[model samples]
Target: MLIKWISAAALAGALLASPATAVDLTVWAQTDLSPSASLGPVAEAFTDLYARFQRENPDITLKYEILPGGTEALPNLLTAASVGNLPDVAILDSFWVARLAETGHLQPLNDLWPAAERADVLPAAIDTMTFDGKIYAAMFSNAWRGVFYRTDQAKSLGIDAPPASWDEFLAFADKAKAAGMKPIMIPGADTEVTTLHLISTFWGFGGDLVDATGKPIFFEGANRTALEKTYALYRDLVQRGLLGTEVSTMDEKALRPFFYTGEAAAIANTSSGLQQMYSDAPTLKGNIGVFALPLPDGGRAAPILGGQTWGIFADDDAHKQAAWKLVSFMLQPANLTAIDAAKGYLPVNQAVWAQPFYAGDPLMQQFKGIFDGAKIVKTRPPVPIYPTISSALSQQVAGILNGTLTPTVAVDQARDIVMAEYTRQSAR
Candidate 1:
């Protein structure tokens, strides 16, 4: 036994010392990690960081694969998992973490990650990467959503401040419309953004899309009532002309042109828009002001901490250690600050938030204030059927906006569409 242990130790030392024996691990993501002129500064920073990592750890080299977002990413990951050919790490969309972790193939990283290092992230942000009470991934970047209004537009329209309460929001809209300005626009062109802009409205009324066990329960009991009320608000907004029918056709990309052209007084968007606002309409950047969506009876909006997370899938011990090393390095305060600040992504790492970038940027400070005021932050549920649930709700939401379905019928139909998949996920 002593002789065998010594031999194994010697082999390990030799491999560690040899450059040819370096671990070459794979990392897959929907986002571009390589430096590209078309991509933002964050990607460029990440590209530099990757090169730095390779230099620092001469024993590891990462193989990168950029996959198609939404349409093919999950399917590719699933196929890879089924064939036992999964990468050492993958960038998981917030919604994909729950589904991918359900495969029982993703290794729970809690044992490898130190609790002290984990504490640097927001507790709610960390919750997004958790499934079945195990931490499956590490979340570093985030896109915090809120309502962005033209500050000068609001001032000229005689609005003293952004709406603070639901009643105030309604009054503010009335004033803006009276002044020949379109009130607020919430984009509904896709499954994700459609629900994202208004889901917090449902949350404010004390409703969560799922229960503690990760079952779809938004259609049950008071949750049903809250959702109905939430949907009714949208239907009523359209009926009253406060929110436009064109919203159903508008995506986040469309929102910039609408707002910049002096068409819409306000729009709901993510923190990343801070950079886009400057790039798309530098003249309007200073005019823009951000506020959380006003919920009924003064309930503060709980910012949904949604973003890409890194999950390790490697089964071998050497690859696991190497993958985690790369992930942890990328998530370090300085590295995260470099990328997140440059790109205007809200930082999930508290240490990154403390950096001068966030402190100096007024737009980011507003987002941070909105993020800090909330009590119960929301993340996509830890269930595989979340995309199904989101899709159903999004479709019904569009129908509700178009007057093709009542709020009750919309909720009922959405429930019918996703229940089976929800049940299957629950069973797993």
Candidate 2:
């Protein structure tokens, strides 16, 4: 017995003396900032950021796989997950967090992440990556949608400030129209943009898309009222000719020439796009201004939050920790600030906001204020069914806008479709 114990102890000591094996981590990242949306130098900027990470961590070998945006990345990841071929770390769209979370493929970060790290994240922004009481991912980049208007146009039309409420928005629209300017441009041509805009309007009208358990509840009394109010707003925009004929065909990018050149008085888009616009047309910088999207009476304003997040996939403790280290490195204030500045995304960490770069910039200051006031919303619910639901809403709303369906019929049909999906999901 004594001889056997001695031999075991010797083997344990030898094992402990062996050098730790190096870890090789593969990271999947999107080249474009958003799905179908590209800001200046996003891919190059991320490459530089990854090079920096490599410099700092000499031991870990990094392999990067750049994925295409818009309907490509998620499907790729899903396929990989099915075969257990997922990368160690991946940057996921904020909306995909919930869907992936439900798959059980993602590692819950609540155990891996520290509470102190969450201290300064805007609560609603944090909600984007959270599901089932655990944070499944960390926000890497951030964006919010707000009303962008030509300040000079508004002032020349005798408007002292941007609209504060839906009534005020309509009144301002009327004035802008009288002044020979298109009031606002809604990007209904792009399904995601259309979804985000309508979601904002619905939320502002005190509507919610899903209940806490991720069930569709938009047809409930108050929620249905909010939906109708949003529908009415869109109908009014069409009737008043505020949206105009081109809205049916033009995506957000197509509206840029109009908005930047002062053909449109106001437009709503992700806050990051503001920086891109300013960069592309320097002359329009001082002429532009932004504000949170206005709400209807008895409602609250919350610009829908959009951005990318990094999550871990490997299950082994060592690999998970190694992946987390890379994620944590990317989240460092300076590194994250540079990435956000390059991509035109707002920083998710509040500490990054304190940096002089954001504080000194007037546009970023406005974003800071928006975050401070909690005027943010995560438009998509954290459910597997959201992508389908969003696509359906986009199509149904387009129908409503084109006069093919009334709001009541559209809402009822949408509800039935979602409930059917919910039942399908339950059966699975």
Candidate 3:
């Protein structure tokens, strides 16, 4: 017979368990909003929140690692996951969330956070994270891509406000050109920026890569029209010397110097750029304005909403629980307030914008207007093979700009590539 020996203190400790016995958690965050001088405040806000979280729960140690920008960090993440060493939490681009979820690498949050609770998030903000009818991540912020224009330039051009339709926009561009000003500053060499700006026009023209049936639909009337319009704009700008020869070499960073110095009348950029301009050129703060990209037919303006999201790694129950707690804490209204105030990103929590900090800001008010009527905003196709689809579009757009391919042919090629990718994804 075996003798059973248990200390009374051991029995009492087991019976009176505390959260201090919880597991440590690790978070991997991409460094998009951290390095910028204007955006540094936002990073500090997140750090403050993390500090408060640690103070509240001393038992659960939290570690956050900042990853490099762009695709350079993806390989490291993949390697870590392959070795069963994934972080407890990570921030992902909304576009990548579906792909990650499909790999079974992320935990679905729907089971833990009820649909009713998630209803608080804007529909557009939540759409990308929902794959196969399951919610996998929580939207952290809402971002919009549109034209940033100089208010005085618009006034001097006899335009009191930014164009409300594609026709009006073109007219304004023509007027600006006749007045000896570069109407728009676009970095043609930066495929990412060019593709993103062109996609906004595709949406404005009511074209999309995927349909309601979840089928690929890129070769069509609106898509062709949008592509033709984009190609024409590119050729006209390049030939007119409105866009510098260095366009092919200019990235978003290089294009910024042109805009801030007022070399170009307008630019297609994200709202975060506006925040930076405010800090770098404070005197020009009230001289700039933001507006949605107008449709060709003078109908509703459409803009693309893009941003990062918080996700949980598929892991043990304890880790999952701790991750959820962190997410919930970070999403609290106060935390979102701090985030928006610091980062210049729109809050996913609607209530956060109603705060005193944002209420008096006119530019913030204009952003709210654009965001409120942003139902037309849509994500690229949610298939796990979106990277391939994005690449094909980028290449086709480049070919169109380089005069190697017509818009019609480029769109046809993009459609074929998307269909093939869809087929490949379906097979898996």
Candidate 4:
């Protein structure tokens, strides 16, 4: 099993609300996986909000359905839309925004949100959900990948703080290596994790996956340099035995034992993983800390902002209006603040950060700093061929890390495959 850590309340609520005669509004979500487990605070809060919405609008009912995962959810959504059987609203991964809208299955929200309400959201978030000059969805929650280190381990290593730059990180890794601790654990089986780390570093070096025109640009000069540096780091770490060969066979879950047991000093993970760690290993709480991933030379740090959005499906007018209303209500600062605080996620709405929950926690405050300075945050290009592109990139990255393919050759092949897919999708 992939072990999707979802919300317990969402699952309970899903089962508890099966009443008769309710004007059901279908919602497609990935937040209601485990019946006894909670996805996070956001899902719990949404579960409550849905209940409240049903209460207020007695005539309009809502039925929430859970999608399997990002990969399955996207294709299912497209298939449903093509058959004119789309749900009322769907929670979509931010990366699918452009591609979904291009298919004409999503409703434009330009007139739905007022100028003032629109301005309340983080600018980068708003920009990410917008496609071809039209806003198609509302940015809701965000997760950023960064360096998660054990504070006690740093102290034991005679390091007072997390590394502020790539060079410093390398030095820290060397120290951890000397102490017989794995500097970091990279999960090769779960390509998303490794890919995110690699991509963040690429962005730190000023490489971009897409050009200004939203075209694939994987073979550019900046990207080549990024790959070379990444491959060098991999080879050096593996050759020195600082990162074990088992890493190549380890899935996402495989690294958790190492991290929880203190065999690994640090890991690059998203905020969601942070939440899960706190739940699964309460002993590690307070000792864990997050820092922005370092940049090359003396450049500023850049974290990849991963998040989700709420999209209204092209459906009946009544359902569309209800969905929009639900999205607007959820975006309210109070709601966003509570949900983010509970779920350990950064609120996409800027005003939500000013709330007491965010203001009072030092850890959260530090998190906010990373979120504020995240300049390279972007959703993957919204293309129907994204899965293929992702898989190709993952294979190439795995090959580079395992020395099965030269970095140059691997990247070049990835670029060719992605470009071809882009052209094929465009011509359709």
Candidate 5:
């Protein structure tokens, strides 16, 4: 047995607790919010939240085990869910919810996480967590992704100001080059990050990533033009010798150190990247800022929202109740604020916006406005095949940046690759 169920009433002196007999829940997670995982204020914030949870529920003992994410995690999850051999709780990525929920192993969270509680967060949280009318998970946080730049380094980079549109951005490149820094670095290798970071640009130019049937349409008429314009941005920089060949190998993580050291003028990143910079490169602290990735003339912003959610796998009522208690406590506005603020996640709970962190953080203040004015906000499509699509698009982007393929050829190849996957899935 992975868990040793102990009732809250039994742990306490009470003969009968309101929950009757809530068991201690076990958690399986791949999260990075552990105190040991970060330094400075981030560690302090996470440590305080965990300590507060312990103080609030002195009798409830919680246990956690690390789990892998991505390809390796899926089969293990499927097998466990099938046999009813699962932990009381799991921190499942939003990306995996569709496939896991389809297996009928995840318990619907509505019974424990009431509608009142659901209403406490952004609509996207509920929208993404629900699959076919069932809410299978409670979202803890999401990434508000955009362009990150160093306010302190702006003078050194020769950038007069943060660019608000593509014309300004193209003009800013010259200023950055004169200062011997890369104008902007985009990830081409980490396909999902690459896709998410650039999809806004593609969508802004009137591109449709997928058709109504969930089939990819990157090479189709208007989308083709939109994609060409998107990739051309990267191609133009390469042609100008502003971006080195190393950019083709870079992902979001690889883009950071350059920014941290003031070697790059700007880069694409999520909210968490701000805290990470504070932790990893303390000197960049107050100098960091973010802006929406600007679009071309007549184009609008398309922001992608991605999240992580808590999934209950405990079958017995006792363990399930305990899991909810643990999950709910972690999600409490004050506690979650510590986690979200320190870890750099955008808050899922609407109440957290009123917290001091949002008010004090300059980057968050700027991002909130960008989020408000965003023309399109959506999660990656909920279909199970979306990952495959994301990966294929990412590959084409790498080719475009590396000069291995023209924008036209890259999209054509991506269309064929993705359509092949749709065919395979259909036949199955």
Candidate 6:
């Protein structure tokens, strides 16, 4: 009896001293935002980072799913939530933060984040993640759009300076055409691309796309004139053969080869594609330059704020803490730089800004300037209904480019759709 009791006590002690079971965390990341080969740079970087996190936290496991679809990712998340299958963590566009927050699908990070930790991130990033009076997510990978051009082509055309106005841009186009090169690559097939052009042009013409109250005011008075002028620019580009007819069927990806081969003079795209450009043609490394989109009159309109935000969905306390630990691990100095470098995105960690890659690189020199001056377009306002507004507006813009509807008619229809959405949300 004594031997049996001793043996039982020893077994219980060994069990108590053994490691606890790991907490499993599920995360959904947008593959579109971070384009890499299926199991490419981003996947490898994240896998290694997760391993490091696991080493430190032996009791936590991470399972990350790469969700595709650029702008449509929000809908997938919402659908998942509807079925009570929301992941522990979600990576959503910063512009869609309000939509998810207002729907009560996000877990507020304020309570979990210490003030000192919050201060370590960029203020602008935090502002995007904040809804009402509370912070619901942590934003990273800040991005901005720019007028990327082939340096050698521009120099050969005697373009010693970036275009300062609309006339100058058109003049450059004419020169490029005379030089036997396509003036620009326009992603007319992409709704997001069309809307971005509209927003930049509209704002440059001193027109507002949305009012302070987050209502669509795109067709009101001078705003309508602004919209017409933007459309006219597109029509003029198409007429001059500077913007090829093939644009209606081609996306931004289709233009990369054109740019690399010197067939296309310039393209207005975000820095997200810059890394791919370098990889596609190493010879063009020193031949590319980035500039902000200039207004017709003179000055530059702000670039749209582009990036992703990480959120912890409402879940049990253990899950929330485990998810946050993963977030914190990914945000670490080495890990953040590795992932952002692999993905071609600007870092949200303020400390990383001082790193040589961003501070001293010649390629980054141009985009850094644009990022400093970029603004969030009205279509992506910090309101719950912005997703609906952006969707309606983009569809109409695509319609104009596809020739199914005139710009004037498209703008009118879009205005009505947005107004209707606003009214519906108000009543709700």
Measured against the true structure, the TM-scores of the candidates, in listed sequence, are: 0.89, 0.87, 0.85, 0.87, 0.89, 0.86
Ranked by TM-score, top first: 1, 5, 2, 4, 6, 3
**What number of backbone clashes does candidate 5 have, counting pairs of residues 3 or more apart or in separate chains?**
0
After superposition, the stretches of candidate 1 with alpha carbons farther than 4 Å from their true spots are 1-20, 32-37, 420-428
**Model 2 misplacement above 4 A:** 1-20, 33-41, 298-300, 374-376
TM-score of 2: 0.87
List clash counts for every candidate, in order. 0, 0, 0, 9, 0, 0
Residue-wise C-alpha lDDT for candidate 1, range 244-315, written one tens digit per residue: 888888877787787888788888787766777777788976577888877665785667778767899988
Per-residue C-alpha lDDT of model 5 across residues 1-428, encoded as one tens digit per residue: 22333555455645445333434657777636455453466567756766776667755656766666545677778888888777888888887888888887788987788788788888877888897788999888888777778876776655656787778777777777778888788787856778887787787777887776677777789988998888887787788876666877777888898987778888877776777777788888778777776676555547776777889888777777778888888888888887778778887676887788887777677767676677777777777667777887788876777788898887778778888888899999
Task: Give the per-residue lDDT of model 4 (tens digit) for 1-428.
Answer: 23443566667887778545445678788754212126555566676777776777776777778777756777888788788888888878787777788779899899888989988888888887777788988887787776678888899998887788778888888999898888887665546666776666666667667766667766777767776666556666677666676677665567777888888988766776766787789887788877875655555436776577889984667777778777777678887665666667777776887898878777777788876766656655555555665666676656655777777787778888888888887898
Which segments of model 4 are wrong by more than 4 Å? 1-23, 32-43, 420-428
Best by lDDT: 1
Residue 129 of model 1: what lDDT? 77
What is the C-alpha local distance difference test score of each model? Answer: 0.80, 0.77, 0.72, 0.73, 0.76, 0.74
lDDT for position 210 in model 6:
71
Q: Candidate 6: lDDT of 234?
A: 70
lDDT of 6 by residue, 271-297 (tens): 777777777788877788877667666
Candidate 1 lDDT (Cα, 0 to 1)? 0.80
Worst 10 contiguous positions by lDDT, candidate 4: 32-41
**Clashing residue pairs found in predicted model 1:** none
